[model samples]
Target: MNILLTGASGFVGRELVRELQQRADISLALALRSPGRSSGPTTFVVGELAVDTDWLAALARQQAVIHAAARAHIMKDEVADPLAEYRRVNVEGTLNLARQAAAAGVKRFIFISSIKVNGEATVNGKAFGADDKPAPEDAYGLSKLEAERGLIQLAAETGMEVVIIRPPLVYGPGVKGNFASMIKLVEKGLPLPLGAIHNQRSLVGIDNLVDLIICCIDHPAAANQVFLAGDGEDLSTTELLRGVGKAMGKPARLIPVPAGLLQLGATLLGKKAMAQRLLGSLQVDISKTCQLLDWKPPYTVEEGLRRCFGRSN
Candidate 1:
């Protein structure tokens, strides 16, 4: 089937492109924001994401679209109005693309969303699920939630299929941001203060997320569905650090700092929210996704981490 994919150069997009390239049955039309060179069976279309960005040509004859491009979440945003900025690109741009794609008779639209839409963290033993009401705390999460609503509305009005996948902390080879920083600290054998953090968090590897995206592209049961994607296992902060350390051939070297003291230090340093991310639980339940498509994450947490760290176990 012929498909149109956006954000072909991003972390997840890069892996998706590599995986899609190996599939002889699929043809890809990559919509990029910059002037990118096209090659092989993939065609690159240069266009930015905005209300006025032209996507008619890209949508033409495409059976499905995997929309991955968006104004990504920033840990320390410098924008004056972050919500407005996110709305302009994520909500407005996404809806613009969907409206045009629907007009062009695109069969399905797959949206890559975040677990933040369900809230920043989970309490007690409860985990975020597909049926939970959205409670986006930050601008980026709010924008994605709005975009999901718009896509569902478009699907209802225009008869186009819409599939939403919310993944929690995707990590793998070439992963950046906090994950990469953690890997570096582990590689250097630096002492970390995460030993007391017993909070559980769910993380999906890039390979597993790509596999689910491929499934949603053509699965009949995926139409108009919201699914959570994970590695099928949750881990504590200490466990995650230890795994990373082991993968990098180093010691965990974690100091047993009290969680309350850590929180207070973060508050004094104006990084309280960031500390919560490291110390609090944010688990996602992928049972609905598995049961719907008869799917399971093909890689275990350890295997995925080993692959991500470029090590063999």
Candidate 2:
């Protein structure tokens, strides 16, 4: 089987390609605009998939497409109108690729959506599932929701299978974004006040997420299914920090501070968003994905974090 993976240079995409390349039944093809410094069973494409590009024609020969490319959120709002920018790439660009894939008679389209589509803030201590109605709060989440609708429509019209994976905070080797910042802080031995907070957040290891993607590629049960994926265990901020510290061969030093104070300080320091994400609970229930795919995370959170921290052999 021929499989095409976009965003091959990304943290997850790079690992996913390497994971698939080792299998005997699959031929790997990577679609990327800027080639990275790694290699695998991949042939790079030089154009962006979101534009009026003719690159999809060459990829049409593949049996499956893993659409992993998107305009990720930055520290500060880069877009003049964030919603418009997100829609252009996340929604319109995604639809364009899906339509072309359908036209090419591709058997399946695998979309990697975000857990934020469920809600920006946590709903009590309860976790959101796949069947929950999309209540996206941010512009980024709204764009992903819009793209998902397009994928469903395209699948209905083209008779191609669609697998939607909504995963929470994925972390692993070469990780960037907010997760990287936390690791650096721990490495510096900075004291964190999150030890007092007991909120839970779902996270997925890159290896575990890659394994789930492999399952979706061929599993008939995954067809036309919406799945929520994460590590089976939901972890608190302190636990996560400790795990990172352990993986990096350091001890975590936490100081208990009032959550309200933290939020207020973050707001004053222009890190209000960061404060909310860290001090808040955002758990996701991945039971549906497990039941449907019969899959579980093969690596523990500590093990995954250690591998990413690069302090282990």
Give the winner by TM-score: 1
Report the lDDT tens digits of candidate 1 across residue range 1-313: 9999998889988888889988999988889787766565456565779998888778889999999999998988998999999999999999999999999999999999999899999999699999899999999999999999999999999999999999999999989999998888888878889887888999999999999999999999999999999999999999999988887778699999998899999999999788988888999999999999999999999999899878887
List model 2 lDDT by residue over 116-157, tens digit each: 899876757888989999999889899999999989988888
Please give the distance, in angstroms, between residue 285's alpha carbon in candidate 2 and its true position after superposition.
0.3
Q: Report the C-alpha displacement of residue 184, candidate 1, in angstroms.
A: 1.0
Local distance difference test, candidate 2: 0.85
TM agreement with the true structure for every prediction: 0.98, 0.94
How badly does each model clash, as a count of residue pairs? 0, 0
Instruction: Please give the CA lDDT of all the candidate structures.
Output: 0.91, 0.85
